[model samples]
Target: MCQTRTVGEFAVSAGDYSAVVVSQGAGLREVRHAGRLLTESPPVRPDEKPPLSAGLVLAPWPNRTADGRFVFDGVEHHLDITEKDRNNANHGFVRTVEWSLYDATERSVTLGVPIGRHPGWPFDLTLVVDYTVDAATGLTVTSTVTNSGDVRAPFALGFHTFVRAGDAPVDDCTLTLSAAKTLPLDPERQLPQGDPVPVDDTDGDFRSGRALAGVWLDTPFTDFADTDGRHVTTLTDPDGRATELWTDTGFRWAQVFTADPDHDQGFPGRGRAVAVEPMTAPPNALASGDDLIVLEPGQTWSGEWGLRHRDSAA
Candidate 1:
C-alpha cells in the first residue's frame, strides 16, 4: 500500500517520491518526469532511510578527505568515519534526521534542521532547505545556513541529485557539462591528492557529449563559467528528451558519479543513474581551506539550484 501526506497545497508521495511543492511559492517537490524518477525520496520501509537520489543538500562540508581528520583554527578536528573505505566523513548532517515542514502551501514547503556543535564539527549553525515547484517550470531548491556560533565558521554546500533519462539505459544517454578543469583523485580511496587538471582527453571531460553506460566516475570538476554565473549540465537520451541542471556562482564544483551494481539499485540494463552534483567547495576543503566560504558571527549564506526539462525540439 502507498502512503500519502498532504500539507496545504503540497502533496508528499511517500515511499515513491517525498516531493513537496508550494503552489504559491516558486518551488516543486517529489517531481517525476517521463516515466523515470527525478529526485531522491525517503524510503517507505520502516528500517530504510531515503535513497541518495532526487535532491539532497550537503552542507558545512561536502565530499571526502584522505583521513577522517581536518585542522581548523589550529585545532585538529576528527569526524566520524562515514565512509570507511576513504576513512572520511562524506556530506554533512541531516542525511538521516527527518526535516521539519515549517511552511507549506499549494506550491512549496520549507524543511529545516539545526547542527549543534559536536566532536567532529564544533560549530553552531542553523540550516534550512526549501524545495519548491513551479507549474510552468520544474523543481527548484534553495539552501540557507547561518552561523549561530560565537566564532566565525568555515563551510560549503552541495546538492546530490541522481538523474536518469526516463526509461533509457545510462549507456545510451549522453552527458554535456561546461567545465574546463577537474580534480584528480587517489584511486584506492578516491580522495583528492594533487592540483586540478584540464578535462581534455580524459574521462572527466564532458564538454562534448559522452556516453555514460559503462563509465565509473567519482570525480569533481571546476572552471564552469557563464555570463550570469548560471551554467548548465545536461543529460539526453538517444531520442533527444533531456534534463538540464542549472546552478549559480556559489556552485563552483560539480561532481559526477556513475554507480556500479555492487552499490546501486542494479537496474537491469542501467547499473546506476548519473549524478549532477553542484558543490560550493571542492573535496576536503576543511583541511585545505581552498575555496571554503567562511561566515562571520551572525552571518548568513543562501543559494539556489534547479532542474528544467528540455524537449528535443528546443
Candidate 2:
C-alpha cells in the first residue's frame, strides 16, 4: 500500500492548492489546482509515475548518453546504466532516495537529501527541494545543491512535469515554445551528434503553436527567449484553459515528449500527455560537456520554476 503525508496548503482567490509529500521514496503525492487535480500522484499506475510533478528535482544529470562512461578531469568515470535503451544512466540521484522533511508550513514545504559518493558518482553533495503555490501562480518549485566534499562536483538539475489540459485530448491542444535550436541526434543511439538545427523547415518547430495530435517529439531544445530574465512556455486547449510553465535563467534547455499509451480511445495518438521538462543542461551533458555545471566546495546552487493557469475566455 502507498503512504501519503500532507506538507502544506495555499489558498488563492482563484482556488486553493495543497501539497502532499509521500514517504514512499519521498515522491510528490499531490499538487491540486483550484481544488481541482492538476497533477497525478499516489495510486498512480506504474506507467504514470515517470513524469514526476508537483516539483521534484533531478540531479547529477538529466537525459541519456550513449554509454555510461565519461571523462572528467583526465579520469574516465563509469555511471550505472539506468536506461537500457542507450546503456546510460538517465536523470540523477534523488529520484529513488527518500528525502527528509526540513520544514513545513501552510503554503510551502522543504525537503532535503544527501547524495554521497558512490561507484557511479563519486561526489558528496546535499540537495534541497522546496515547493510552493500561489493564487496568481499555480505552483513554484525551487531547488538548491551544495557541494560538501573537498573536491569540486560536476552535475545538473531539472524537473519533469506531465501536464493534462482538463478534458481536452492532447491532439487538440496547442504547444508554444520559444526555442530557436533543436539538438540533432544519432538515430541508432539517440545521442547528440551534429550541431543544433533551427526549428524552421523541421518537424521540431513549435514557435507558432502546433497541434499536438500529429506531432511526435523526443528532442532537446535550447536558445530560448530570455523574457526579461524569465523563461516561459505555454500549452493551450480548445476550451481556452492554458497551462504556463516558467523557469529561471539556469534552465537553458527544454524537452517536450508526447506519448500515447491508450490507442483504443480513437485519439489517433499515443499517450495524451505533454511533458514540459526544464533542465540545466542538455542530454548526455556529462559526456558532451555541454550541460556541465560545476559546484565549488561549500558552494550552493539554487533556482525556481512554476506553473500557472489562465482562462483566456474568463
Highest lDDT among the candidates is held by which one?
1
- In model 1, the runs with Cα more than 4 Å from the true position are 1-29, 34-36, 40-47, 52-54, 262-270
**Residue-level lDDT tens digits of model 1 in 194-307:** 999998887778887788867777789899858476878888989988877888878889988876686654433445767778999899888898899888989999988877
TM-score of 1: 0.86
Candidate 2 local lDDT, 1-314, one digit each (tens)? 11223222222222465545543234554566655445434354322333434234567777775578888777888888877866877777777666776766666667788888767688899988877766666778888889999888887887766655655677888888989899987766768888888888777878877788777776888988899787888788887677778888889998776655542222122245667889999888888789588888999998888777767663
Give per-model TM-scores.
0.86, 0.87
Q: What local lDDT does model 1 show for residue 173?
A: 87
Worst 10 residues of 2 by lDDT: 1-10
lDDT of 1 at 47: 22
| Stretches of model 2 off by over 4 angstroms after superposition | 1-15, 23-26, 40-42, 45-56, 262-270
Error (Å) of candidate 1 at residue 256 is 0.5
